[model samples]
Target: MPLADAKQSDAPAKRERAHAGAVRVVAPARLHLGFLDLNGDLRRMFGSIGLAVDVPRTELVLKRSQTFKGEGPDHARALATLRKLADAYKLPAGYEVKVTSAIPAHAGLGSGTQMALAAGAALMTLEGIDHIPSRLGEMVNRGARSAIGMAAFEQGGFIVDGGRGELDRAPPILVRADFPPAWRALLVMDASTAGVHGEDETNAFAALPPLPADAAAHICRLVLMQLAPGLMEEDIAAFGDALTEIQKIVGNHFAGAQGGSPWTSPGVGRVVGALRAAGGVGIGQSSWGPTGFAFAPSQEIARRLYDSAIEVARREGLEILIAEGRNRGASVEKIANT
Candidate 1:
């Protein structure tokens, strides 16, 4: 807890925006992309699309630590999410927290809902409290079933949400946009497999089997007529062909929990099919597998699909790069409390 910099003037404090005390937060590593109404018929379900990237981030910080702790890169899942929001908002759990950098945990990159909404938004600005990021992601369970990581921690762009509506909360932001900043993605990681999260992702959605209401109504008319008019007409081939036909219909219904193969890592699914055969066009796999993505339309076509998938992503261990879309969110500062 020693990070002082309101403007120390060396240009190192913008952990994505916001700076002042021992309360950092950062965030940004979304990209769920797919799941527009997982067939709840009309009662609502898991409508998504997400984006908010800018390369694997999470940050975290907090101050005053005599002991209630956590330390870096998944600090024990950020001290079990700061001991469940410090015992559900009783606050002050003797701060020490420091997840210096995260987002890799389960590989689908929502790293446990962005480390439980960046440890409940840095303990609500170190206990000033005043909730709202879905009520501090409901005291730390961080949006149970996609609100696009609590609206990408409060407003990064290109979202969509509007799903779980029977009153469980979390799914709401029906649209956000602005992701066409010269569009570019790539991603592709695979840090040695890790995606069917906790309790096997609730028993792979209770052993999946329902999605048919006319194929969830034709993937909701390809996200309202071809992915929101190819993201407001930037038109990366009509938004990569409506996000590769909604990731081939939600990766063939989660490909029998990914063993049937929507790719949990068949070498990052052959480097996302050589980054969509080197043209990279909104490929798939992001929220339940060895991280994959593609979508390129600038930055020189994502550096020619990262130099044509950098040697088949290093002969298939995988690691492609090039990200972009993070239209602002997550950044809560307040340093100098050492």
Candidate 2:
């Protein structure tokens, strides 16, 4: 898809393109800061914080169609649910949805959820449904519940989902704050190695030991006293320390269920250790398993960390990806006449 300005004037002599029904929706990728300790049956209900990143994304284009089948069966199911929701209130049907995303599959970026939501919103538009955006979250989650979907559909800063609740509850209230501009997150991932599957992933959560109150209290304090304030003040050092501490604590708690250790990715401990040795701070895993992220105050620091990690990987013959945090929102691609 090519980027274009809707504001551009169309040649008066050219025919104006038209479609029976069409809409486009862009959904951003997300990063989990830490796992929220949700109460039993609610699973991670304590409410974890998540932020959108620009690198990986999901885009959906919807138009009227008589038949549906192909590559994304999950997306198809999501569209069907949206169509049913539209019909419950007397709305149009038959939609063609094309989904595209940059977020890596099985990397814990919520790619499927984002695609589902983008498709859902576009389907609603194609069907001429005029419902509140608040309802979109729950509706989308019915098909994919990665919370990142709910968070991206809503916007700004950090977001948390309160679990199965009324649509009126909407997306959990977002706590807005700018991540320090100097901070760069180097995401080290392994594409060849697969992590836990979705259902097994859910089971992993189910198997987690109830978070001890002491640990939860400690995390709550760090969020309140250090993390939130540090970001607000743009205090990189303080923010890094708090984040690093929180990650260590949470990582330990999660280890019980994942066997051996609850690491974001393999060899993450080495990367975190190397980054720390190189004067980088704020390091941890995102969610579930197999992707590690660490913070550097500047490109200089990041390079140093990357160089060291590279040497280590070479010695062991491993592959890793290094990505930075995007201050802006998700990238959008508008399909032609979409």
Candidate 3:
């Protein structure tokens, strides 16, 4: 990591200092470009696979509140949590939470998970709760099934959630790689279509084949032998190979659930093929997506691939987002003093 810091002013130089009345936080959106076997009692082999992208951010602003009421279950729960934290830490009495997000709903980007984690973080931090990234991730992940989102928000990078278990301590594993500064992740998402509904999602998995013991072992091999080593060395060739291997294994597993290859979305197969044809190194669909992603080596490669993908999708009259992998994550700014 570089020691020197470079600061660029986004606004003109100001002569005044403002008191902090609110805490602001930003959480990055994630792409589970690939999800493996379904979580079930019959199989101890299932795990979530994904990376955090630099698009569709979730931002939060927390300020002191006075006699505010929360209407929804999630909102009420959040308020209750914040109140408890405040009482425990001897902090302020009232607070307000304002959330702004660009991440689409149910596109498999982990948007909801990100928001939940960010809100939790803001609440905790404002109440003087001392926390490490991993601890904070664990705390927030309790509110949602997606632990990867909490991990991504805590430490920006490629990550995977180990998945919640009966033990209640599913930690995240951050991929060991220095994402190239020029690399960009473009998520081609279709918001018009809905993914597997929660009810259907559970039932779908229930009906799927139980994962064989060998299958989980094979996934572990892809992660350790290929993905882990390749990522650590920043070897695109190796990384691409590993991703391809995982895609095949995981894609096959999801097949039984969707009554097909489990590519989930009807339009993703063509895009994945198109991306590969356009010199894309690795490509896959996010969990139950109407969203597909293509990984390029560089910006030039990304542009070329994106163009090719757009052309191919045009034939089907389908639209997708062209996103880039971000080295650094989202940014949060304080817009007002109060």
Ranking by TM-score: 3, 2, 1
Q: Residues 202-235, candidate 3, lDDT per residue (tens digit)? A: 7876676766656666766787787767666767
Q: Residue 17 in model 3: shift from native, Å?
A: 19
Q: Give stretches of model 2 more than 4 Å off.
A: 1-22, 36-44, 69-93, 131-134, 142-149, 160-171, 311-338
Q: Over the full model, what C-alpha lDDT does candidate 3 score relative to the true structure?
A: 0.60
TM-score of each: 0.34, 0.76, 0.77
Candidate 2 residue-wise lDDT, 1-338, digit = tens = 00132112222202222333466666666677775454334343545666665555666566656655323424664566555444443332355666653466667666656665566566545443443334655544432333544655556354545433434344354365555566666766666555565688789767877777777777767877887888778787887898888888888877775566757455765766666777777777777646677777776777777887877755544444544444454333334454
Q: Which candidate ranks first by lDDT, i.e. highest?
A: 1
Global lDDT scores for all candidate models: 0.77, 0.59, 0.60
Lowest lDDT 10-mer window, candidate 2? Answer: 1-10
Candidate 1's residue-wise lDDT over 174-282, tens digit each? Answer: 7888788888888889787788888879999888987888887888789889888888888888888888888888998998888898878888878788778767887
Report the alpha-carbon TM-score of model 3 versus the true structure.
Answer: 0.77
- Per-residue error for 324 in candidate 2, Å, reads 5.1
Against the correct fold, how does model 1 do in TM-score?
A: 0.34
RMSD of 1: 17.6
lDDT of 1 at 109: 71
